[model samples]
Target: MKKLINDPKNVVNEAVAGFEVAHADIVRVSHDPVFIVRADAPLHGKVGIVSGGGSGHEPMHGGFVGFGMLDAAVPGPVFTSPTPDPILAATQAVDGGAGVLHIVKNYTGDVLNFETAADLAAADGIQVRTVIINDDVAVKDSLYTAGRRGVAGTILVEKIAGAAAERGDDLDAVTAVAEKVNSHVRTMGVALTPCVVPHAGEPSFTLADDEIEIGIGIHGEPGRERIKLEPADAIVDRLLGPILEDLPFASGDEVLLLVNGMGGTPQIELYIVFRRAAEVLQECGITVTRSLVGNYTTSLEMAGASISVLKLDDELTALWDAPVQTAALRWGR
Candidate 1:
């Protein structure tokens, strides 16, 4: 209930306005329908990469707009999918001669809305491709999605696919890379405390002080189970077990292990989770070649974290190592 804001309904618009000012050098915002585009867009002959969903997941779709990543991002309201008009606008704005790819999460509203936008863009002679991220090993269905909910693994998809596009890969190649990342990645989250929505002015869900919810969604959706709080290592085991089994990531496989915070967890705690995850992977004989630990994707001030593992091949490794300069992720540049 305690949020720093003028009005709940205007939170998205206002927050976006602040973001535009803060990162103006790298991005530009369009207000008519509200989408964020890289300041230098329409790179000729390069495939345009765009991904978006509800707001509140900071440094996600919008924060990722920049060189070697998303050329454009369309953000909806807090935990709500954007309509088609802005998505189409973003697509058109970023399209070069190559084509545009929409990286949608596996949420029903996001899928349907992006589909409508793709159709509209195709009508205007813009080739459009879509990839749906469904890497959550937590659940098969949730309130927001029909299948596994796309969780933190989305960052891996966008980064790898965007690198492919930045290297002048064709539309089909970029789409394939995106799908490959989605297939290789698996994620699961746990929540220690619930977050309050601005409009609702109350917690979306409840957790006792001594309890935790495993396999939580980014939007505070119901997770796999609630149990009395356990040590961080035990929690990491609970999450990593499902993720590893779902992908069956084999021994000798190289991976990019990501320990992501759910907005509120501190870096100290995140590293604890990562430490245990790395230990488990090492025991399994899975090599952790690349590693990322931080708040990449998040719920609105929710106290939790998610661990993602992307089984990496040489090609995927190179793509991840490529230069990237975005608001949230910047490296190799």
Candidate 2:
């Protein structure tokens, strides 16, 4: 119930307005049915990348719309999947004679809506393709998803694939890179507190002072289980153990590590978890060539953290290092 806003229903509108103004040099916001497109959209001959989901996970589909990242992002209500209209608008806005790629999460509503958008765009003579992200190693089924839910690993996929598109890779090439990241990455999260959707005016879930939800999804989906709170090192181990085991990462394997805060977790604590994650990977002889530590994705004001590990190869690493200028991520520019 405690949040800064004039009206609960207007959170997404207000937030996007502020965001557009703040990052206007890099992005442009279109209203009357909302969508975000890069400041220099419709880059002739470049394949466009579009992605979206519920609104609370900030700096995600929207913040990533510039430079070597997404060209457009459609946002829905808080924790609600967007309908197809804005998505189709985004598709049309970014199409520049080349194709468009839709980077979608595995949530049911999101999957359906994006699929509809792709179909609508195709009917309008625009080539459209999609790559779904289902990297959460937490649960096979959850509240909003049929299979595993997409989580922090999505940022890695967007970065790598967006770079491919920016490098003039065809739609097939861009989609292949995205799928590659999704297949090689694994993520798990633990939540200390659930977030409140502005309209609902209540926490999405509940937990006691000494309890934590392990392997949680970004939208407060049920995780593997809940347990008594543990120390930072223990939590990090629990998050990374399954990831390393699920992927056939042997010694000397190079990987990219993302220690992401789920909105309310502090930077110091995330770094503490990252420190433990780095040590564990070192023990396993996995070399972390790149690491990002911060709130790249978040659940409203939830207090939690997630870990994403991507087994990398030469191509992915190089693309990841490409110049990317955006609201949240910028490097080598």
Q: What would the TM-scores of all predictions be?
A: 0.99, 0.99
Candidate 2 per-residue C-alpha lDDT over 1-333 given as tens digits, one digit per residue, 9 for 90 to 100: 778898998999999999999999999999868999999999999999999999999988799999999999999999899999999999999999899999999999999999999999999999999999999998898898898898889999999999999999998899899999999999999999999998888787899999999998898988988999999999898988888888777899999999999999999999999999999999999999999999988998899999999999999999999999999999888
Q: Candidate 1: worst 10 consecutive residues by lDDT?
A: 196-205
Off by over 4 Å in 1: none
Which 10 successive residues of model 2 have the least lDDT summed? 241-250
The lDDT leader among the candidates is 1
RMSD (CA, angstroms), candidate 2:
0.7
Which residue pairs collide, candidate 2? none
- Which digits, one per residue and each the tens of the lDDT, describe model 1 over residues 164-278? 9999899999999999999999999999999988888899889998999999999999989999999999999999999999889999999999999999999999999999999
